[model samples]
Target: MTTTASNSLQNIVIYTNNKISLDFYKPFEDGLNPILFTVKTLEQIPRKTENKIHIVILESCDELSNLQINCNKIHLIMPAFLKNKLENDLHALIFKYEQSMNSQQALENLYHSFIKFYCSAEYYLDPQDFFNSDSYKDGYRCINIHEILQDNVSYEQQLHTYLNTISNTETVSFNFSIGYEFSSESGYLQLIENTVDHLTYAKDRDVFFSVVLSKHPLSDNRLAIVHLSQ
Candidate 1:
């Protein structure tokens, strides 16, 4: 699948290690509404839109450049000290997992690091607050959740937690609103349980797999999708 602008201008925010890039569909036009801000500037950008905004944080500018070839609507930004802390945490987790000699344990460590990084840095809304906000009116808004993992079980557990929590009633259509970055086929199936549902995987070399859940099994009123990548 290719990244295309649906309609109207969507606001996107990105945080990275002082460098990044974006890639999107061709026929790129002007007037994109995304804002690029450093982590330090997050407080300056008050009144963030709920449904119309997207955010991404890369490890470095080179990663950003690689992303530019695949996504067009991304708003690349630099992270504050948080990025460094997250990186340090990730490094420690990875190193520990590698020494354990268990691939599954390693993957779990990576997944946990990913979740912690996003929850602690990018997403300002608490889980409860996110569900209550007007931005969640149509359901959960689409968000790209990324993580680098070393094993499958850890990834699966993370998916289970995310889907189960977001789909809960208090979430008010939260499951239908977000996308994910995953590393395996089992993880994908775990998120989309039905064989009847159609899955659209992206052709971009950088994106490993993607699926948009048009409807959630728990409720017909809510819609959601998940995107995964290695």
Candidate 2:
């Protein structure tokens, strides 16, 4: 199918408890249109529609748990802490079926040294604008999740491109460092250990694949390495 024809068949439906102002998602309305719906109403929509639905859950509701198991179809957008907790709690059993193939290779590559930093609420709340700004891209290049969501492709395809970039890096050992005031190297190292453990198990999960550094907690000309892959 042509790119335009394929894009017309896909759209993002974000399910949330309360009705969020459409204005928040206004900028992303092009290409893959974004629509908001509550869990109750989401069920009411026809299941056999022409458009391929990409579900994004804003807040967890009990009714959505069954659908949540299919990570490809349903995406949960909770706080960074909550997502981390879920990754720690359920990652092992969730993808146990593929352990034999992925675990060993993933283990040997542990020394690659990667880190996924959680963006501050300020950045995530208006990710479109923050990602578009030159300030965040001053030190290094990044893949903007907001912009990718606006594209005519699936998140998985975009993720594949990102993983390929990591694999193609010239050096294996990468480090993520923040300014001294916000955290010490030891504290940051501990956080990285915990995050990598969860990440190692559920590497393909999109929620666990962020590299954006927090913009708040330090508002100066200080430079922080959000991600380092060489």
Candidate 3:
């Protein structure tokens, strides 16, 4: 989605991949340039200017700490599968707030908790939870992107069923942290197309990447893409 910022100018810098739709940004495009970048590598991204309030939207938290950019506000776009945990947390908090005697007082604390846990950080996600193995071993190895996708390949069976209900063919990205016990092999996967330049990855492994393919809303036969947790 969308992030609210306190800027008269409403300046923004959006990072995207093919899967997410930028149509949601049409209204703000005229007032400000809203610097945008297609996520592939950090080097290609334009450098951030100083003392400016801009919204930065990124696909994964993998490069969040690595990137040396400053912005007034940031939005971490996430995949559909990953939203469950955060939503569950919110629902749980709302329930807790409803039950508490000091509901009004607790609401303020809840707001701060939300901001601090998910929003206030330099980046919204932690890399260790997603890619790093916090085991006894000190060294790590890069897992092939193909292997990552293949491990979750069973989702291919229902790929067509999901694509058939594509009322919106715009980019909707997502972000989530994978725990130390996290294993890609356990998740439900729906693969579309998996063709990247190289299969070997290190920093990128921290990113759980996949794509969803469907027909364009207007165009015929042409495919629309959605990157999972990109």
Candidate 4:
């Protein structure tokens, strides 16, 4: 299954992995369901069978400059080395733009910049904490030590602190989606429902969290959250 968000001109592909089951949440819309896709028979789909699905979130689309697409079965074409170079260049461009803007505009520009540059793609980071550390002077990339530590912080305290720090700049909100493995056993839906409940009831409002579970060795079951303010 593939999930994509697009406006009239640009499309953003959010995810593209060949996992049997996936779940995600987007902001609520008056006439649309927040649960984007709930495919139960994904395992039956043949490998390399490309399928396209699009969702229209009016508000999100309005703010978006490009469409985001997430696929469960498609392969991204770019080579790793080239992709990294492109990502780094994009980061530099964004940083330069941020430096040119005032604080308030910088924040807004940062969001749009990320959406344009890094959405639906993974960027490489050094495992030695060289880039992740808060002391790092370079802030050109997103996967730094500051973000790793920030993700592990207590949701409540972190959210409150982040909001307070950025309060003068931009208003922020949190959204979460819990993705679980596919199950043939009964009560699978109930399990997912409970997980969603836990995420919704979570006290964090400063960092948006996304919970993903996969059997792939490269991936792990954990909450992937990012702070988005202004």
Candidate 5:
């Protein structure tokens, strides 16, 4: 179960307390195969599995505290509404882009979409409080790639060190936005490709990454998101 591409085939195991209907998991099946498992609590989820584990928690966020699940691949569905909201927001943004055919508007939507999705992982802290905390600095959360790059560091080592600093967290989400101050579309695409080549070096870790291309300009022309679980 690799997170290299969105359409890549993956075997998923869904763990839930029957809070969500089977229909909700159907969309993921479009490109991946999923096997459903209903568990009364997180403890019931297997510590070892060949399939990707997705823990869907509809009720208490406290279940995540002091957690100890050992798996190569794991994800969390905290609050239970995140998937539906993401789908809806993306749909709305598509409609808006189609109606206006405004490229800038599309770029803005692209940036907001990733940010919103990253912020939706509210299992540890409320979005507002999380943003206000020292962990969230200059739009980067958990690990700051920019700081790591300044010292000519290894991203994998830096990522591991940062993940170790986070206490009681089994999963971490990363969101990055990259833009070009002035470059051709081909140039931007090349930059994106190169950036991905550099970041996806840690193949042994269970990390999910998403990259969106847009014409929006940023001071540094780069944005990134990395979600990981162990």
Candidate 6:
């Protein structure tokens, strides 16, 4: 594979401290020449002053907040759905994204951190293929659920709890909408106050995920696609 093989303008930066994982990224390096590196693997990262869209992937969830790096790296925690997908397919999709630079990870949606990761990977999956597999015979599930959340912290927390319970899963994602009326975080969360307990058990067999939010006294709807494998 060659960098010119796919004409994309995206700059992907992948960092990790694990050695065995380098082979997993060699394809990306040869295909896109992405800024792939581990702590001691590379001499140094690209200059912070470079004008480029940086997408960082962490192989391990090591807390990088304290690390002093010049580049304002946008670390996109890989979505659960992507961790186990066809490696070759994922590589090709990412290259296309670079060339187009068009995605659903907008600020208004606020999905850049997590959703971009999802879009760059799972968004390419055929929806028809996903809904048809009702059983976890393959040990994974592509969950698409829409729900309301009463609090930001609670919503994100419960989302993480499910991920933690899944097989080697660490990343979870969802969209949360707020009515134009709710001027405060507490108030926005209150909209889903009544459904908190039920949402905690979203994996139950009887729970049917919705593509649309339940219209009630709220104007904002939250969309969440939590890919968890119990």
* Model 3 alpha-carbon drift over 4 Å, by segment: 1-8, 17-20, 26-53, 58-73, 78-230
RMSD of each: 15.8, 17.4, 20.4, 17.5, 15.5, 17.9
- Top of the candidates by lDDT: 5
Q: lDDT per residue, candidate 5, 1-230, as tens digits? A: 22322322333344544443333333321122223334445566665544332433333334545344554223333332222222111101111223332333333333243322322221111222222222222322222122233113364465455555533332233443333334465764564454445442342333334333324445433334333212
Instruction: Give candidate 6's root-mean-square deviation (CA, Å).
Output: 17.9
For candidate 6, the per-residue lDDT at 130 reads 25
Number of clashes in every candidate structure?
A: 28, 1, 7, 18, 13, 5
The lDDT, on a scale of 0 to 1, for candidate 4 is 0.26
The alpha-carbon deviation from the true structure for residue 138 of candidate 1, after best TM-score superposition, in angstroms, is 22
Global lDDT of each candidate:
0.28, 0.28, 0.26, 0.26, 0.34, 0.32
Best by TM-score: 5
Local accuracy of candidate 6 as per-residue lDDT tens digits, 32-146: 2223333332224454624333333323223234233444323333333233332221111111112122222211122222223222221221122222223333433333323
Candidate 3 residue pairs in clash (backbone atoms < 3 Å) = 20-171, 21-171, 78-173, 78-174, 78-175, 79-174, 129-178
> Model 1 over residues 116-222: C-alpha lDDT tens digits?
22222222222222222332322223333334222334644554455443322221211211223333547545544531122222232121122332222222211
| lDDT per residue (tens digit) for residues 1-230 in model 4 | 11233222222222312232222222221111122343322223233323322111111222222423222222122211222222221111112222333323432333222222222211211112112222222323322111212223364454444334442322122222122343432443453343334332223332222222223222222222333221
Candidates 2 and 3 compared: the better one by lDDT is: 2
Global lDDT of model 1: 0.28
Instruction: Answer with 1 or 6, whichever has the higher TM-score.
Output: 6
TM-scores, all models, native as reference: 0.25, 0.27, 0.21, 0.23, 0.30, 0.26
Model 5, runs deviating above 4 Å: 1-8, 21-44, 56-58, 61-73, 77-224, 227-230
Better of 2 and 3 by TM-score: 2
Which residue runs of candidate 2 sit more than 4 Å off their true CA positions?
Answer: 1-9, 24-51, 60-72, 83-230
Worst 10 residues of 6 by lDDT: 88-97
lDDT of 6: 0.32
